[model samples]
Target: MFRYFLNRLGQGVIVLLVLFTITFFLVHALPAGPFQTEKAIPEHIKERMEAYYGLDKPLGVQYVKRLGTLGTADLGASLRLEGRDVSEIISQAFPVSLQLGLVAMGLAICIGIPLGVVAAWKKNTILDYSAMALAMIGICIPAFVIGPVLADRFGQQWQALPAMGWSPLSPSYWLLPAFTLGLVSAAYLSRLTRAGMLETLNQDFVRTARAKGVPEGQILVRHCLRGGLIPAVAYIGPAFAGIISGSLVIESVFAIPGLGTHFVKAIEFGDEPVLTGIGLLFGILIILANIGTDILGAWLNPRLRSSR
Candidate 1:
């Protein structure tokens, strides 16, 4: 297991390096300065600014410098936001994104798994049809549309929750945004769960368990659920990375000060450091999540552990 973990970690490092290299060049290739302003600065001032940020250096030199900074775990300062480091911005924003993501993921797992299990168990029934139809609707509707409609209905028309903004101190502030993200994720999870459950239920082991007169619920829970959850576990890794990065539209609609908001602003303003920092962070999160998924998958499937 230690050797396996080391191998995965090495692979993750290689992936991050590749991701950083591509993003660095692509961001620099864009046709503008990171410090572009509505009012033009004097040429000398601009030159000084460029030199201050080491943008005056050759591209290769800048690239090497960026790698050096990354080696020391320094994200450097945000070009657009005076005196603010990329690390500081990320530190401030990530907690909100994490909270929102955790709530959403929890809701998705809690609701989607049960719905999918029931639908699979009662295949060809009204309950199955209704659950699937709901999942379809959830999948078809985009988060941007759902978020505004939810805000309007619950925040404006009904006055059940605030229309926008997040308050960490208040649990009420969490519900709308969490639901907006969770419902969409749940749709995908439910379908995957149902498919996995159906396949597992038809397996030889499941047949043997039934033949041996195992209680139906115990067979479903103990014998089938672990295998049935494999697909969902696979999906959850990347899905979770996406959620923790924050939903762009959901954050905008809810006026949440999360990583997604910073990411968008960084792009719009051509803040290269911030953009690359967030991209690097995202890559790290995705790689870590995948590693976790692999570990969990091995635990759930004894065959995987033996093969490893």
Candidate 2:
């Protein structure tokens, strides 16, 4: 297990390195600098600004300097937000995103798993069809669309919740945004879980369990659920990363202040450092999530444990 973990960690490091390199170059390759816009600036002021940010240095030198900072766990100051460091910005913004993501993930697991299990257990029935139909609607509709409609229905018409903005002290602030982010993922998970459960149910071990007169509930929970959940477990890593990063449209619609909002502004303003910092953070989250998924997968599947 130790060796397996180390191997996965090493792979994750390599993936992050590749992602960082690509993002660094791509951001640099953009046509204009962070200061350049429709208005013209004096040449000397531009030169000084470039020198101040070390943008006057060659791209190779800048890359190496940034790499060194990364090695030392220093994200440096934000070019766009004067006097603010990237890490500090991330620290302030990420918690809101993290809270939202966790809530969404919980919603997905709680609702999706039961719906899927019931659908699979009662296949070819009205319950199965109704659950699948709802899942399909979730899959088809984007969060941007769902968010406003929910806001209007619940927030405007019914006055059940606020239409926009988030409040850390209040749980009510979490519901609308969390639900919008989770709905699509819940649909995907339900389908994936149903498929996995159906496949597990058909396996020879399941038949043997039934033949041996194991209680159906025990067989389903003890024998089948672990295997049936493998796919959903695997999917959680990347999906969770995506959720925690904050959806651009959802954030915009809800007026939530998260890393994603900064990310979008950074792009528009050509704030390469902010963009790169956020991108690196995203890569790290994804890599860590996948590593966790691998560990969980091994624990759930004896074949994986032995193979590793």
Best by lDDT: 1
lDDT of 1 at 110: 88
Backbone clash tally (model 1): 0
As a TM-score, model 1 comes out at 0.94
| lDDT per residue as tens, model 1, 26-131 | 8888787786778888999999999999999999999999999999999989988989999999999989888989898998888888888888888889999999
For candidate 1, give the lDDT: 0.88
Tens digit of per-residue lDDT, candidate 2, span 202-226: 9999999999999989988998899
Ten residues in sequence with the least summed lDDT for candidate 1: 240-249
- Give the residue spans of candidate 2 off by over 4 A: 38-40
Go through the candidates in order and give each one's C-alpha lDDT. Answer: 0.88, 0.87
